[model samples]
Target: MHQEKFSKSTRTNKQVALHTDVVVVGGGLAGVCAAIASARSGAKVVLVQDRPVLGGNASSEVRLWALGATSHMGNNNRWSREGGLIDEIMLENLRANKEGNPLIFDAILLDKVVAETNITMLLNTAAYSVTKESANRIESVNAFCSQNSTYYSIFAPIFTDCSGDGIVAFNAGAAFRIGSEDKYEFNELLAPEKANSDLLGHSLFFYSKDAGTPVEYKAPAFAYSQDEIDAIPRSKNIGAKDSGCKFWWLEFGGILDTVHDTEEIKWELWKIVYGIWDYIKNSGKYEDVENLTLEWVGTVPGKRESRRFEGEYMITQHDIVEQKRFDDAISYGGWAIDLHPAEGVYSEKPACSQYHSKGVYQIPYRCFLSRDIENLYLGGRIISATHMAFGSTRVMITCAHGGQAIGEAAAMCAKLNVKPKALLAPKLMSELQNRLNGLGHGLAGIPLTKSDVLLKAEIQASSTLALAEFSQQDDWLSLAQSAAQLLPFTAGLAPTFTVQLSAQEATTLTCQLRVSIKPENYTPDLICKTIELDLHAGEQTVSLDFSEVELITQYGFVIFLANDKVQVRTSAQRVTGTMSVFNKVHKAVSNNGKQIAPPNSGVEEFEFWTPERRPMGQNIAMQITPALQSFAVSNLTNGHLRPWLGSNAWVADLSDKAPTLTLSWPEKQTLAGLRLYFDTDSDHALETVLMVHPEKRIPFCVSRYSIKLEDGTVLMTEGDNYQTLNTIYFKQTISTDKLIIELSHPAENVPASVFDIEVF
Candidate 1:
């Protein structure tokens, strides 16, 4: 295959053997994303990876579910990953593939990478070495393929090392740190007393399933006893099936060398897994269920902690716990500081600590690129950061975000043909921001528009926006108290990076959004330098301008308001309303006239009736009712309203003999027509069916009845269908003032749903 392919290329005789815009090494989540983003932006990209599949640690090898910080489905913040390329991929997988869950995930990643026009992925490819002649700019890379048993050469203008081990940067001559450093290095409160060999460790997670039959296992000698296995504690149970997998299982990292002792850890875990199962079935402590045994075991050990690269910025634990904000914040991680034991399971270090912040924290773009490597962009676990900080930033959701960040960075490098390091300045970063937003990657053009952002007069609760710092001190009473933060920020060492001015001339008030990517969430400090604005006993308009400021190190907007001491107000509009994000009405699909009774002979057909009111957003109701109903559904997602009685959209009640219009939507353009259902009930209930319309308003034709006999006599309508009240032959256009609905017509014979009517 190589010789045949080479002959074709040699005939063409291109002077440059291997040349491209960007070379992305490591076909993991971050690598694929970077390659796709760069290629989409008109850059030629070469994707190289040693692994067979693309999802990196979160792949079929380990079978762990994909998660992001802001993409959680339920109201619970436990599973949110800010919806992005990853979320879109998961949805696509759910729609198309129905193989086992792991295979489904693998297919999703493959489809995204292969379908892209600009990415050329080389699988089963390994990077033997990276030769960087400039120490700053990446010149080219050398890779070996096991499939062909041959070595090849590849050259690209820009390079990215998303290998999760920081291998690309390490080879690029970039400085990085691994494990805990001296506490003085970052002044982090969670740092160990001194630097050590400890890392967060890794796990090989596989679903525990028994295919319909229980298997008897011969317990291994090294397997942990039932007591010991149970002692591990099902501390973190996630996913729909409750897949028992501890992400921060750092025990192996401490008990054994994670990098060198991978095989040993696997050997030991295999023994422990079977022994635990044997004891569960034979121990007689619990009732045995059918097919209750380990279903699948992970072949690849999911690596949690690896190497770190040096970037333009370093996020710290203090930044998270303190709720710091930065101007260059390209992303935000909503998960708690889910740090496992720094010193393995049996060590002296605490197992974990809560990342209880005042609110969501932003991830600055500074952490995306290596400071030393001018053109090389890094992401995911390989992003530059100290070990203690990596603990909070290394989760899947944040890593996915890091993927997007570096992806955008690769795109910018190729588009401008400039070193990524040169783009770190705020001026160039704005352009990057525009690019990311365009691809639907960064915080640009959020579905919530500027007009969608509701500006208000006053907040009822005062301290909702104060810059209150929570350390071991302030209780996390804020989110429960008001769901808003009112932090009174302390100034960082600076020459006032921001200046805030109120509109009022008489009163003087000012605020400065300072620099400091730590303490206060590494969020740029918005310090109120002065409080002299127009609050003349009433409402007034005031604005603070930071448009002139050059740098915003972290992410998130600085909302500034002025008051005499303070005024009550509620600013910032939530994407969905206050009740709940699940206020949607599902339109039940109709069966082919099978479940519904036929309309009378005189009537053309029956259609379902419903209000055009949309469901109100975000709410939970145990019972559906008129006054307590929700109607905030989107324009396309069930904008029509259903009866508050129950989930039945427009069911025909078969209790009466007559089909009379208790309620029907008026074919009018007024709100009255749409809101009539608010006060409707069984009085407005249909004994039969109402005719559905194509417009927002539904027209329910009165149910008329007629039936023919074998003797040629018929009870017919005097309406448009016949000339006389009684007729033998059927004609056209039947009409009726009252509907002959099938009431008391046995519960089994009634048609519950209505769509459109058809006349034969």
Candidate 2:
């Protein structure tokens, strides 16, 4: 109906200018977390994402699962899930989309971003240029959206680059490295002997489904032929059942430039994907594939490695392996140094070489600040880490965890009217850590900030869990592989444990009491005592006495060596801060019982004692001579969230009916908000995609809860809660001298547990 007049040779699209406290580039999980954290911290945030939807690698387009410190629960880091905003996203995803439908995940992320009033999300907007106020500071970023034909000029004092390719940082003259570092540069044994351009590659995935009837497939001209497909060293791994990320090894373009060569990489990956489908359909190798049809295939490849910007301090291999402590520590990581072959799918070498640390390690705040650009925060995989350290920190969840820290720092900077590096001051750094910890971000060895208001109140629970026994159930676990029961110990002589066991034949069981060298860690590196028990053919009770050995307060592992002839009883009772781990193999993450590294690889060799996922992984049935009094009412005010040096949670006795925690003060106090931390079985890896979880809600999470006054007036009632952090803000401030929190057990067999309670 309307016609536009003719324009000059060059014409510009619609131009828009925006001003905000913080601007975050990229829409990956890391950037999403960064924007959310900043917005929640009272900063006006503008989140610029180049894609149509958020969750870069984790989006439906790429379809890679989001994982972090839990490492699929394939390592020794127990209760190691990254906390705060990332935890909320994963738990929410689990509750709404535990089946891991990529499309559903996309909706969840979009919902979370849009719900934040302080956040202005600009999707499909790519920040292509950077405008600097000075050589070291970025004044604004210039972005464009081709779909809308719009140009956006976003001005902010603080800019965070969560982009996987370091787009903004690159344009802003931020120092970055794109290749591996020399071994001697950082004295990193895991580094290459000489610096090289080799890096992890890009990968594409396809999904197939049964049509209930025969479906035919025809190969396009670009698809690889049988002779070409046969040339791949790992072509034998292909099967009819494999789909999506299960074929993560279907990678390419590592040797080529990952950033500039992305399109070329996508084409090669497509050729490989279509070629594989063609082989399955026509090569007559797979039988059941006759009814299978290609359901979905990735349009864009997921990039693993690209540009790594320079920060004030670069984490190295030794920092990870030795579990180095940083004064400015803000976050933690536990995934192994997983490196893929540069040759990708065509290489004869193993698909990946992974070396795990003994336990979780700390990441310092200096690693998030740009070395050259002031007011710039580096986030995601681009954070300052050497090639070796990046191997572990490059995972999506780990990046997102660090992204929360970056966002918080940016908010703090805006509030203080200073540059990002100014937060490195001891007092400011402590404040930053406290803020992150208050939000439930797990920092190794960092205690929660003491609340003076909460301290003045007297806390009492209906009944505290006593160190007694996990009642034996009908289920029995076979001892075909080594198994261990993780238990909390006091700072004295180890207690005696009596376990019920049945033997297929008379056998001798070797029991060892072990603890980690570091009390804060769960790895059983130190063997305190060993005992041998003789078992009969029939079921009998056996005692493992380690009373002679004195130990510090920590989690002790009562390990039973593998004896195929014996089986141990399991308990239906699920307790907080307790789990049974097995020395087994998880082929997905390449964990094969133990990690045996090559000599001089600078990697430590340790056995992987990981917990099994639920529906299984029941605690071993055992009775103690002296009840361990680790879980107490005082633990509620201990200023620690999760299971750290000890069980930092107050767990109610299993027999207590209508469990409750009461906080009483001498005088009436005004309360506007209350924050509660619940046990979400942090040991369980909540993978964002692919794997199916047993329960939509964590078995140990509080399903229903109510907050009431001493007069019995209900303040807040949560009927179905599945998150780790529950913040309740009253519609109006209430004044009360006493408050009661009534809780229901998440599961019949699982006791009610809470880490900490804060009132504001």
Compose the digit string of candidate 1's lDDT tens values, residues 114-225. 9987888888888867777675776777777778665657788788887777667877788877677767787765566688767775565545555577666555677777
Q: How many residue pairs of model 2 clash at the backbone?
A: 0
Model 2, residue 266: C-alpha shift (Å): 0.8
Candidate 1's displacement at residue 730, Å, is: 50
lDDT of 2 by residue, 519-540 (tens): 8888788899889888889899
**Displacement of the residue 503 alpha carbon in candidate 1, Å:** 50
Candidate 2's TM-score reads 0.99
Work out how many backbone clashes candidate 1 has: 71
lDDT of 1 at 33: 74
**Best-fitting candidate, scored by lDDT:** 2
lDDT value for model 1: 0.47
Full-model lDDT for every candidate: 0.47, 0.91
Candidate 2 clashing pairs?
A: none
